[model samples]
Target: MTTPFVHPYLPNSAPEVRAEMLAAVGAESVEEFYADIPAALRLTGDLDLPEPLVAEADLSRHVRGILGKNRTRLSFLGAGTYHHHVPAVVDEVIGRSEFLTAYAGEPYEDHGRFQALFEYASLLAELLEVEVVNVPTYDSLQATATALSMAVRATGRTRILVASDVRADVLSKVEDFIRPYASLEHVPTVDGIADVAAVTALLGDDVAAVWVSTPSATGAVETAMTQLAEATHAVGGLLVAQTDPIGLGVLTPPAAQGADITCGDIQSLGIHAWFGGGHAGFVGVADDPRLVMEMPHRLFGLASTSVEGEYGFGDVAWDRTAFAHREEGKEWVGTAAALWGIAAGVYLALMGPQGMVELGETLLARTAYARKVLTALPGVSEADGAVHLREFVLHLPRPAAEVVEELRAKEIEAGVVLGEHELLVCVTEMTTQADIDLLARELGAVLGTATDATTHTPVLEEVAR
Candidate 1:
């Protein structure tokens, strides 16, 4: 297709352009709408790229050939991204017209994209049981960083204590970004859990926020929120919880656990697990007026009041009554993918609270079962027994790289082992019992067939521990 030049200004809006357009169309009045642009901006030069088009099937086959160069495997890896099964119905439902409204609330300024944002934000607030939400930012890292910056501004504290076993990349990113502004301190871990004593020692006059992750990156659960919140409260600091939304289904929310700021990824909620996004991160605060106003992203709410003549129905708008600054008020163009994806998430949520909980429970149970099966296999063993959420790490008797290679050769994709021996495996609601057995059977066969397989599996098992 040839590129067309669009006018920067409208003919109907500009008197000269309107007259020119009328003359070009041989029309007596402006009402005759068909028009052509002036020859000056129109190109007479030849266009360079793709002068000719290929047949549809040929093009498709070419694209497929390029794509097929990449190897396919039954993925068992999940660090942040999981291979969850997305229902086909999700795509169909998100395409509905009712959900495609823009964020602009007024008739004159109605930008339909913002309405989708508002709808998404409202859905998240209702799911999280928070007063408001802002559906901006591409991922959780931005959300956390923004919230941390806001917390620093609000608290005037230069010291922030973070848990030792937090997500590795998130911590690295936060340290790289936040350390330039304040003193970033790490809370020591006690058996894969955040050490309360270490965090307590670090707290005092200059502390702004205390961050801890639940189901720590090592797969250990932390139940210290109440005390953590109390300690932060006593020292005039905020307790921030970075949660796994999948765990949220079965576990207590940050608000229920007394966390002042609840910030985490919503990736597990009906969004495709493609590259760990396009998931929205939520930063909700406890219902305290003092705390809620400090929330970073602001969602529009339906507010009502009487007009001069009579009562009137107010339309949708972004509500900032409980937010901090004007910068947060900018209308975020709803990423079409996330808005549509999360609407599916709302459908997942609306299927009822029980269904959500069951989804979480099912994941937990299946993950546990898969763990047992993996451990029973020849070269695999459980590395940590720290009460995993949906996934846990395993120690492979063979080198993780080698085992992953072997699995790949067999068209089975397995997890990557961190350090020297640990392989992280995630079992979502999508991982079936059959899939689990397939992994087990494959590992068992790899133990017998490959060169020194018998020796490597045992040697790897010892190295795994």
Candidate 2:
């Protein structure tokens, strides 16, 4: 006599509808659908789930309450992900209805979207000093993976030499993606940057590319790029350089530094670090047909329209993409981070050349000051002698992880822990001088306490002995 329960949110949950659907599918009951699943593997009894908040208002309140518990803390943690200032204009532009709501619309339907992405590619190409740039990949990691794959295809070689100092996450991604088609070798480093002599030694006929990161994971600027490129080319291999687009304002472009292919993430360009959600990858190559034909992602180009003096934007090499050939394509291309590409385009339009240079200068000045202050503290020292820009390594007396935990308790997020005593710290334009001073003071106090504890603990141990 009990009324049958029906889910308020799920459509066709009513008893009559369920019976009708089951009858239409020639199944007497829902259990019949799971007949293929073995009894041992099948779940039994009621699922351990909270009572459903059926009402929209109740669900909103529940989600808000859970989110309220998160405390906002000042963070300096940047390994691959960074915390940079996103301009208000960038957000306003991306939030528009046409850009935000549109899916993968065609060129005829989404002309504005196509033009916007083309502008983004053009602006990025200008910055990187490359001739051709793709729309974007999933992120910089994917861009790098694809770039290496392109190198393999172009050189007809299976071996890739990657710098040992690349960020761990990026290196992992490249390893996973390239394992099926190519073999990866790590080039050793000297003083935090790639050792050109070692890289030269690793190069051979089997090598397809030599991949290096400028302003590497340890924040050391790679000065031997031209040498590395020459060495790679000497063995008939390509040079792929991974760099941060934000740093190109001051640092030399990878393509200009003898890179055959350049790739990097645009997250630092007017994109908010929403728990690492905001990232889009860019890959650039020279005008050489060999390199351009190997690109898997869409490339936008401008052409003259039927109307005189009017131009139209559309995909350049549409026939080469996975969208056209499916299984036969060089690589699988899925839905891109097109929204983030648009956001980065807006940011570049706003910043222009001078603004970008000023921003780079600001970061340089702030980072130098931070290093000077923190290195002056007792029991704290620089991990490497190389010159750094936005990020650097700090050797601490205490465990870096323990220091990070203590700082978190005080509502401050210290940098990423590299090891027991090594911490990788990042400073961007968002970080102010006062913030740097505060971190230095807190770090000094923590190290002072740790040093005293170590000084006493050893004494007690010696007395016991």
Which number leads on TM-score?
2
lDDT by residue (154-243, candidate 1, tens digit) is 798778888647777777777776775776788778766777777887789789988878767766667777788888888998887777
Weakest lDDT window of 10 consecutive positions for candidate 1: 456-465
List the global CA lDDT of all models: 0.65, 0.86
Error of 1 at 276 (Å): 3.7
TM-score of each: 0.75, 0.86
C-alpha positional error of residue 74 in candidate 1 after TM-score superposition, expressed in Å:
2.3
Give residue 457's error in model 1 in angstroms.
Answer: 21
Q: Model 2, range 95-214, lDDT digits (tens) per residue? A: 999899998887778889999999998898889999898888889889999999999999999999886489888888999999988988887788888888888988899999999987
Runs off by more than 4 Å, candidate 1 = 1-72, 97-123, 126-129, 305-341, 447-465
Which residue runs does candidate 2 get wrong by more than 4 Å?
Answer: 1-54, 449-465
lDDT leader? 2
